[model samples]
Target: MHPKTSSALRKVDAISKLLIHTQRLLDGPYRSKLSVSTDLESSLSSCKDQLDYLLRKLEVDFTQQPNGKGRRRDKLLRPFKISSHDLKWPFTKTEAEDIIRRLITAQELINRALQVDQINVVLSVEQKANLEKLPVANGAIFNSFEDEGEPECLPGTRTDLLRDLNTWIADPKETRIFWLCGMAGTGKSTISKALARKLS
Candidate 1:
């Protein structure tokens, strides 16, 4: 197999695995979180189905190629880019060609629907707004009257504590809890506020 073709196949395998895992998560705890209504589940399921179909189609297309050195192999391994022009269908139409076309559409849908970023899982506009309206830390509200405009952390102070906390965080099998202790006026709350800001 050509090197590029091998690389493309590997990527397809990785993406297929990720899609399957995402599908499972959707079926699991995230089902209610991701859903807009009953239809959101169906849409996510459809995306997973399309991704599976695309992966299979990609495998068949690559395998059917003779030695993976021909135009088909090159086409399959080509890098995707957004172009203003519409893609041209192959002159010689076949069932495989039709499958390939559908695969492209499926891949596009999956990309748009499943692309998650730093903002947790992918959410629709309405979902995002609803989530924002939710109180922080499970409805625990903090009054900002005195706490407003507080510094995220006390700069240049609590260096030792911060270092120890960072070490704890980086420890592979570390316990999940960290206890901070200090005398009454020793700025424990400030340290906590700083730590929360840094962590968040």
Candidate 2:
């Protein structure tokens, strides 16, 4: 097997284990527990963190629009919001079940993608051509040959601005366009390039 496929399979296995563990947690005696236990919270937190990491490793972007027979994949990649309080004991059973269902769906999608070969799994040739026609700003991306001399926020500089932008990106409620307006030579382009690199 190719190295990428092997790595993806391992991630899928990890996701499967997490799903099973969560289901068992909900099915076990803890399901009826009312007290908030540190152990339960830790377990839940670890599970969620692992799931997020695994999804990232698999390059599963919930933000991307799925096409063609990707309706199922789209459903599998549906984003969910969870706060720290959600990880506390006496957790919502329905929410836990929903998470398990989503994990299972994601696992299935990954398996199917691996089976069919990864290249162009989500786009057809015509769709690719259409996307190719979209205009992209030259040198707008960080580390491009055209912007090789460009610096990215000088390590630790613009920390607050970067944080705010990331928070805005993660927020589903803030659906408005994020206009990064600033005077020329004030580093607006630098910040944009940094953000683009971070997301990439």
Candidate 3:
């Protein structure tokens, strides 16, 4: 609870996370054979432990710096965090790490987005020469909260919803958040699985 001790812990946590993600980036694509010497998974496991420890430490009380006449942007800025608990499907630790990295990047992207009046993603080889060159939301996918709409009969037959998934794939721009309602006759999980497979 001491300020100095808490601050030191905070600093340590920040550096550890930075190192972990940097390592992940250096490791390159998932399951790349380039990973040698140190095992990829063991390293990840250690990093996860470090992160968990930090989170537990964070649960104790701490104080942020008092707002002063700092940079104007500092006053405007707000912290960003994704609610992992809200996911319909729970992710493995590895998946969670990737999601955390993405959420961090997305927070930065939104900051950049605010400054730039207009931003449209255009995929080009030349553009991907560097990290900054990469398009924001290049491969991002998300589901939305389904709103009130006319009940269109659940896609396809009773066996599987793979039939109507073709339509979902055709539209790349939209993020469909499906809310499955109704009785046993309505194929909720089936439709979700088919949509997931199609996306995959």
Candidate 4:
């Protein structure tokens, strides 16, 4: 698995655990007793902050759909007034229900993100294994031969080209195959390896 993705998964897992803890506090027998507990307030605040951070970091745009229908989806959580006192404790039953509802929604989103990441990791591992079974011809395959030095573009070179390739790879609308055609020794392999490393 990619190091960055692993780190993200850990963070998301932590957030999910925090949400669960908070939900249990609200549902437990000591709920009324801990209504004004500083710990409870802090936990709720942390949950809100972490959830917002993850949503932004993941770029999980609630307005967009995979089908390009341009229709907006329901928000993960309703907008709350931006004040520290906005999350006051001693929550009413209705307020507690609303909070639980939002927490469930956030958990659902987190689960979906985890599923997507797991799918990508599995696909990546399977693809690499399949590639390993293929024959290597003069190091034609990327990282196929350990003795042969891997081809990669030199640092500070092909900056514009790399940026364009990255943009094309990111844009869902630009799904066509990008052909990096050049002369035999014109560093096409190098550029390809560099792009692959960047994506990885």
Best by lDDT: 4
- Where model 2 places Cα greater than 4 Å from the true spot, the runs are 1-134, 139-142
Per-residue lDDT tens digits for candidate 1, residues 18-136, read 55665676678666654432234454466557656655544443333355455554565456642212332212346545544554565555555444421334345656898789667
**Backbone clashes under 3 angstroms, per model:** 0, 0, 1, 0
Comparison by lDDT, 3 against 4, better one: 4
Ten contiguous residues minimizing lDDT sum, candidate 1: 82-91
Residue-level lDDT for 140 in candidate 2? 65
Greater-TM-score candidate between 1 and 4: 4
Segments in model 3 whose C-alpha atoms lie over 4 Å from true places: 30-33, 37-40, 62-200
What are the clashing pairs of model 1? none
RMSD of each predicted structure: 16.4, 23.6, 23.0, 21.3
Q: Give lDDT tens digits, candidate 3, residues 102-148.
A: 44453344334323312222333334566566466532223423422
Q: Note the residue pairs that clash in candidate 2.
A: none
When summed lDDT is taken over every stretch of 10 residues in candidate 2, the lowest stretch is 82-91
* Cα lDDT computed for each candidate against the true fold: 0.55, 0.58, 0.45, 0.59
Cα TM-score of candidate 4: 0.34
After the best TM-score superposition of candidate 2, give how far the Cα of residue 110 lies from its true spot, in angstroms: 16
TM-score of each: 0.30, 0.34, 0.25, 0.34
